[model samples]
Target: MHKSIAIIYNQPAASPYRDRNEQSAEDGVLVEVAAVEKALHFLGYLTSKIPLALPLEQAFSELSLITADIVFNLFEGFSGFPETEALIVEQLEALKLRYTGSPAAALKLALDKAETKTVLKQEGILTPAFQLLDNATLSDFKLNFPCIVKPNAEDASHSLNVKSVVYDYDALKDMVSEISGMYGKKALVEEYIDGREFNMTIMGNNILTTLPISEICFSLPQDT
Candidate 1:
């Protein structure tokens, strides 16, 4: 059976690197979409490519088009919305269409760093001390200084940068305000780990395996 696939990626407004020309304009997301499209075309999948400014509806109802088979989930975000990842999956499930990548709950859990940390902490895992914010109170309790501030509900380093490190109360307050205003979400401030850095990647549930652990290499005059 032939299938229609939608290769979606992060949109501009939701991207923190929207203005970052580290490589080129357009944030290079189109490059990703194009790569995936080309790869599938190389394969034997009768795929139809589509750009998503909306959710799963993007796969259908565009110039009178609708997909009847599998939908290769490539959507990173929709219409500059940061939390739209799971939303797309949900729409797919509602349509009873098979796609790829993490399920909706995983997307929700991974996107919410605070919840993920709590689950980890409850499981006796180590995590940095953190705080959540809202319109009312934001860190009334003591939070470790020289901390890192990240959006409570955003990813892709939205407003996160090396400058996200703040050492004083006023700086923290300003950062929180800016983040809340810009992303319609709270900020999480956690103690900065000054010693070392590392990363771990896990693929497939109930079938866990570590390929190669990543390490941070501190160069002279960089870590200091």
Candidate 2:
């Protein structure tokens, strides 16, 4: 039951590098912002929309002038700048603004696949061994054959499909190259975790509230 300034993010509209062969898609939607704004409106928040596709200084400067009482921080990114997700949250904190959901540091750790792995290791969570393959770093990496390749910072199965599995040196090179080039992000290739995947949702702040555990299943594998 309070007014707030909400920051929201979604992929900016862009035509895929047009080729005569590329068909179009229905324009994407900003579901997160829409749903949050709807809920806040019901709760008496005078919500104002902030469409960000530029630098943080622009948002920060404008927020400095806005009269919103609290910030409902939903900004997942600032347009083309995905790395600045947590940085913007830090800006909000420095500006003495309160927002919703997880903090900036948590967002950054989860957003980055590599850093998350390091933290998992620190917490004694068993994870597949991983190697970061930039143009310069992987010379000594002794990856076993039949490794999996994917873009480092990408989530949502982007650039990951049947072809993402590699069985030889050349296959690894090609998969890494394709993911890095096409996704515009670093590639994170690791030993494929050949196990059942589980989805769990953790809710509530102080008290523990959990939804029933969910299992993720896939079609049976084909013999190579």
Whose TM-score is greatest here? 1
> What is the Cα-based lDDT of residue 167 in candidate 1?
90
TM-score of each: 0.76, 0.74
Error of 1 at 197 (Å): 4.7
Model 1, 1-224: lDDT tens digits are 54556554544445344554322333556777778878887876666665666444553344134363666666676544556778777767766766767888889998899999999999999999998764457648477788888788766556666668889988888777776776677777788778877777777669887768898665668556
Q: Rate the local accuracy (lDDT) of all candidates.
A: 0.69, 0.68
Write candidate 2's Cα lDDT for 2-37 as tens digits: 556555453354533223122121123367678878
What residue pairs clash in candidate 2, if any at all?
152-186, 152-187, 152-188
Candidate 1 segments exceeding 4 Å error: 1-26, 55-69, 134-139, 195-199, 205-224
Worst 10 residues of 2 by lDDT: 18-27
Query: Model 2 segments beyond 4 Å from truth?
Result: 1-7, 15-29, 135-139, 181-186, 195-208, 211-224
